[model samples]
Target: MSTQNYLVISALGKDRPGIVDELSKAILNIGCNIADSRMTVLGGEFAILLMVEGNWNTLGKLEEAIPALEQQLDLTIIVKRTEARDSTARALPYVVDVVSLDHPGIVHQLANFFSQRKINIEDMATTSYAAPHTGTVMFSVHMTVGIPADLHIATLRDDFMEFCDTINLDAIIEPAQR
Candidate 1:
């Protein structure tokens, strides 16, 4: 019987063409499958976080191959064994949208509010752009938050709205359609 070995791998380095090509080639050479991943350019650097699965021998080969790729590509790489998790959606999902005039600490304050309330932010993205015609700098955040089954929905919504009002942000919380 052959059981799969799962790994969580992270790579970060100066952004350039061929980073994904080279890194993925290396993983493929060892017969590993890239199961789930997130790749993005952060400032001048490229960041990658991926989960891979393979058999024992292939995974061992991958361990030996990573260091060479690090040197050749000028990358910082980290790998760790991870237990496989079910990807099926669980818990109630809600979408939180916020818009406000550009200002410091907006993300931090919102994150703090969720953290204090034990809310899980499953995914989030933020962007800054100039409002049309007005030329006012505006910041916007879109996030998917997972609300635990036991939490009272109305109370959370009320509290979140109150906090947003205090901070002068236009915000909305609604159920995320699956």
Candidate 2:
């Protein structure tokens, strides 16, 4: 039986076409599988995060080839081995949406509030754009948070709404469908 080894790979470089193709070809050549990944363009840079799976020999081959790829692509690459963890099936998932006039401190304050309450943010994305007609800069955030089973959902919702009100943000909280 082949022993499964997991590798977490992260890379960042100037945004350009063919980066994914090149990296993917390299990974495939080494016989590793791209199990999960997230890639996005942030400003002028392309950020890549991937979880790859293979046996020891394939993983070693990929490791040896990484330096040449990094040099060729002008990328900063980091690779790490990670142990798998059990999924949090017991945690309740909630979608939190917030929108307000663009300003600093909104994200920090929101993160702080959740952190203080021991909430876990699973995924979050934020964007800024000009509002229609008014042309005022507006910020919007969508996040998936994990609420522990012991927490009271109604109480949490009430407190979150009140906090948003105090900060002049329009917000909504609802269950995230699986």
Which candidate comes out best when scored by TM-score? 2
Model 1 whole-model lDDT (C-alpha atoms): 0.91
Q: Which runs of model 2 end up more than 4 angstroms from their true locations? A: 1-3
The C-alpha stretches of model 1 lying farther than 4 A from their native spots are: 86-90
Model 2: clashing residue pairs?
Answer: none
Q: In candidate 1, what residue range of length 10 has the lowest lDDT sum? A: 82-91
Clashes of 1: 0
lDDT of 1 by residue, 37-139 (tens): 9898978999999899999788888888889989998999999988787556456889999999999999999999998988888888899999999999999
lDDT, candidate 2, at 100: 99
Per-residue error at 62 for model 2, in Å?
2.1
- lDDT of candidate 1 at residue 165, scale 0 to 100: 96
What's each prediction's TM-score? 0.86, 0.91
| TM-score result, candidate 1 | 0.86
RMSD of each: 2.3, 1.7
- lDDT (C-alpha, whole model) for all candidates: 0.91, 0.92
